[model samples]
Target: MEGHCLCGAVRFSAPDAKDIGVCHCGFCRRWGGGPLLATHCGTSVSFTGAERITVYASSGWAERAFCSQCGTHLYYRLLATGEYFIPAGTFESNDMVMTSQIYVDRKPDYYAFANETPMLTEQQVVEQYGFPPEDAKS
Candidate 1:
């Protein structure tokens, strides 16, 4: 799938992308105003207008990026593996299924999705992904 930032300042293509994973972590909510509906594009995403991308190191192990021009969220990337979780809304067209949601325990009760998808708590996400412990700071 191919897509670009709101102002067309950053364009990207995620080859063979499929599943859309929802992240309800606090950081994601504070960053995007709600849960992050993103696709795990791994390391196969290609980008254009890279110079217009601004990145923020949101955590010790991951960084989030956006278009410097429009402030559109571009991706949340894992530093060590170069895996990218690009926002689903960024895709021009997609038929990807919403398979799972992470950080479900942190999700506020004000909103909820109608989709019946598997959910994982913060601890489950960390353990499944083999992320460093919260106290590790990296």
Candidate 2:
């Protein structure tokens, strides 16, 4: 999948992108004003105009990045596995399906998705991903 920032200052491609996942964690919500709709791009992403990207260490095990020029939310990366969960909107268009959701317990009650995806609570995520309990910051 190919994508670019709002201002076209940073472009990227994830050759292995297949599906999208939702993250309802507080950090993700705050980062983009709502839950994150992203794709697990593994570590096969390539970039152009890298200098326009800015990264933030969101937590001990992961970081978030965006385009400096337009502040377009980019990707959330796991430091341990070098995996990248890029925002779904970053791509121009796609056929990727949303199959899973994380931090379901933390999702607010005001809105809900119609998709019947498999959802994982924050605790379940910690256990499944082997993430430190204290690393709930994400």
Candidate 3:
């Protein structure tokens, strides 16, 4: 499926993706207004308007990308693997499914989902997804 930024300056394509993952980490919440709804697209994803994309090194292991033209939250990427988790909203599809959530312990009490999805806390996310080496700061 294909997705684009708010101003259409940054467009991406994620092939054969249907599952949406929620992330409630502090950085994700503060990045937007709530949990990040994204799809793991891996390196298989491709982007257009590369010049308009600004990537911020949000953490040691990951970077966040957005449109320089309209500041649309684009994706969270792993520095080591070039993997991407594109924003689900960008896909503009109603068929997406919420299969899992991460950084669940950091989720605020004001909001909750009824999806009954499997959740992983910060430690579990680190263990399962893996992170950059100690010296590999992004």
Candidate 4:
């Protein structure tokens, strides 16, 4: 899959994507003004114009990056496994499929998705990931 930053300053390619996941975690929701639709591109992503990207440590295990020029959210990357969960909208095509959602309990009642994907609550995400609950923080 091919994608680019909002200002075209950074371009990236993922050899393949496993699945798309929605993160309803408060941090994710606030980061992009809503849930983050992320595509799981496992550790094979390459980048061009890498110098223009700025990374912020969103959690102990992951960092979220964005293009400095345009403030476009780039990717949410796992620190240990190097796996990438990129924002789906950054891609040039809409081929990724949503399979699951995390922090479902954190999602507000004002909006809902009709996709009927399997959802996990904040506690469930922490259990499944076996990580600290920082990602579930509001």
Candidate 5:
């Protein structure tokens, strides 16, 4: 799958689309500049015009890459997962994307799920998705 930033300054491609996870945490909310909708692609995810992609250490264990030109919140890499969480909105076409929303309990109270997609709380994430709370400190 292929994706890019809003200004077309940064581009990336992923060989296979798997190991995807959706994050609804507060940091994700702030870093993404909105609700974060992401998918975990491999480290092989290559970038074109790479210099335009600036990275910030969003957490102790992960970094977020964004388009410096347009401030487009692009993707994040979890050191433990060895996977890149690419924003679904950034993809050319998010046809094959399937997300299991995590951090539901911590999600903003203003919003409610209207879709049938499975929603997971923080504990559920730790238990089922191997997401350790310790690594999530922002």
Candidate 6:
């Protein structure tokens, strides 16, 4: 799968088009400007316009990449897990099949999950993603 940043300055590819979902954490809200519609791929994901991709160390273990020109949040990387979580909206097609919403408990209180998708809480993240308790404290 391939996608580009809003300004078209940054582009990336995901070899396997699986493990996609929405994240509703506070950090995601701030970085993504909304719920982070993301998809997970291996570290094989590469950037084309590397110079335009700016990274922000969002946490001790995670860093987020964005388009420097347009400030479009592109993806989040978990160094330990070697996972690339790219924004779904950036992709050309929304053919993402599997999904598992993370940080459900911390989701915005104003909105609710109207869809029938499975939701994961902080503890679930710790268990499923191997994120430690401290890491899941968002």
**Cα lDDT listed for each candidate:** 0.90, 0.89, 0.87, 0.88, 0.76, 0.79
Question: How high is the lDDT of residue 75 in model 4?
Answer: 93
1 or 3, greater by lDDT: 1
Question: Which structure is stronger by TM-score: 4 or 6?
Answer: 4
Lowest-scoring 10 consecutive residues by lDDT in candidate 2? 129-138
Tell me each candidate's TM-score: 0.93, 0.94, 0.91, 0.93, 0.84, 0.86
Kindly report which residue stretches of model 6 are placed more than 4 angstroms away from their true locations once superposed: 133-138
Which should have the higher TM-score, number 1 or number 4?
4
Give residue 8's lDDT in candidate 6 (0 to 100).
88
| Candidate 1: regions farther than 4 A off | 132-138
Tens digit per residue, CA lDDT, model 2, 1-138 = 899889999999987566889988888898999999999888999999999989999888999999999999988999999998889888977777889999999999988999999999988998998876544445
Pitting candidate 4 against candidate 6, the one with the higher lDDT is 4
lDDT of 5 by residue, 1-138 (tens): 888888888898987564345677878877764567777777788889888888898666888888889988878888777678788788887565455788887787777656567888888878986766734444
> How big is the positional error of residue 32 in model 3, measured in Å on the Cα after superposition?
0.9
Question: Poorest 10 consecutive residues of model 5 by lDDT?
Answer: 129-138
Cα error, candidate 5, residue 42 (Å): 2.2
Question: How much lDDT does candidate 4 score?
Answer: 0.88
Question: Model 4, range 1-138, lDDT digits (tens) per residue?
Answer: 899988899999997675789998888988999999999888999999999999999887889999999999999998999999899899988767889998898889999988888999878887988867754246
lDDT of 1 at 105: 88
**Number of the top-ranking candidate, with lDDT as the measure:** 1
lDDT of 2: 0.89
**What ranking of all candidate models by lDDT puts the best one first?**
1, 2, 4, 3, 6, 5
TM-score of 2: 0.94
